[model samples]
Target: MINMKETINHYLAAWNEKTATAVKAAFQKCCTPDVTYTDRNAPTYTEEGGFVIKGIDLLTALVMGSHAKVPGRAFSLLTMPQYFDGHCHYSWGLHIPGQDEKAGWDYIVYNEQNLITRIVGFLPEQV
Candidate 1:
């Protein structure tokens, strides 16, 4: 069984480490092929069979672009203490350079085998 907390931290730590390989590895370590995602206010949204994202490719693009913005951003879980209706809730408090502190819960939907298939969370506007 995968430790959800560890997995989440692993992904976030990659960004803080500023290693592109770590970032990509983090995604691979936690995400599933059917992974889907969504932002709070996206321009063009599409159904990823779960939370609405422009698309998986778009998610990748956005994440990739964020790396260059003053490296060392980290997402720390603030509080996430429940599991119901097949969705795990995780409240995160993040510290990112050039960006104000933002916090929100990520709704993770795990695949049948326990890999993260989709996640939806709130975030602030990026410059």
Candidate 2:
């Protein structure tokens, strides 16, 4: 079980920086080597059943794909510290930095190894 608080913090920071490299690093740290980012129904590629960005190269591609969409977005702790048996899932109330309002909910699923396996995200709501 990993404390995602720190990981999420770095991710949100990297997003605002628009530094693709930083985001990539954070993702690599939190996710496994075979990490897959699901871009289901995303504006860019809602036609191909979403993209399965595998490995570091593809992970960076996925981050680049989302760069233009959710610029300056920051995540806020929502569900707090949660535990499920030995695994855990948590949600965050995302906010666009400088926007100062709740954007949407993003979920992160972590395994016993403290590596993220799934990432479920939604577009920001009216805020």
Candidate 3:
């Protein structure tokens, strides 16, 4: 039985890490070495459709770049995470002043070892 809340928080914590080392460590804690991550609004896209990011190094770089772009941004869950089997779904938002913006949804798949194997993200509108 996976602790869904803890898993979701760890995933978000990876994105909110302030330093490269911290972000990398956070990712290592929650994700597998070959974890696949894709977001609808990602800058890099493939010919097959959708940008696919594989492995921890790339994942760390992605989050670090996001930090550089947004600086001091924090991601928080907008709804309780729902889990089924090895997968989970939840909505999240960026901490913007005076706004309760539900930015998007993330569907996560974890391995039996309790490491995240993949994440599929959907952002309807850019924040």
Against the reference, the lDDT scores of all candidates come to: 0.59, 0.57, 0.80
Alpha-carbon TM-score of each model against the true structure: 0.67, 0.64, 0.85
Could you tell me which 10 consecutive residues in candidate 3 have the lowest summed lDDT? 41-50
- What is the C-alpha lDDT profile of model 3 across 1-127, one tens digit per residue? 2587787788899888888799888888888899999886456422334488888888887787777676677888888989878988999988754656547889999877668899999875755
TM-score of 1: 0.67
Q: Which candidate is the best by lDDT?
A: 3
lDDT of 1 by residue, 11-126 (tens): 45543545545555666666674477765643333223334654335455445555554356667778843554446777777787677788766777765445567777676544
> Who is ahead in lDDT, 2 or 3?
3
The root-mean-square deviation over C-alpha atoms between each candidate and the true structure, in angstroms, is: 4.6, 3.7, 3.2
Residue 98, candidate 3: C-alpha displacement in angstroms: 8.0
Name model 2 segments beyond 4 Å from true: 10-14, 39-51, 97-100, 125-127
Error at 5, model 1, angstroms: 2.1
Q: Tell me which of candidates 1 and 3 scores higher on lDDT.
A: 3
lDDT of 3 at 52: 87
Per-model clash counts, in order, read 0, 0, 0
Which pairs of residues collide in model 1? none
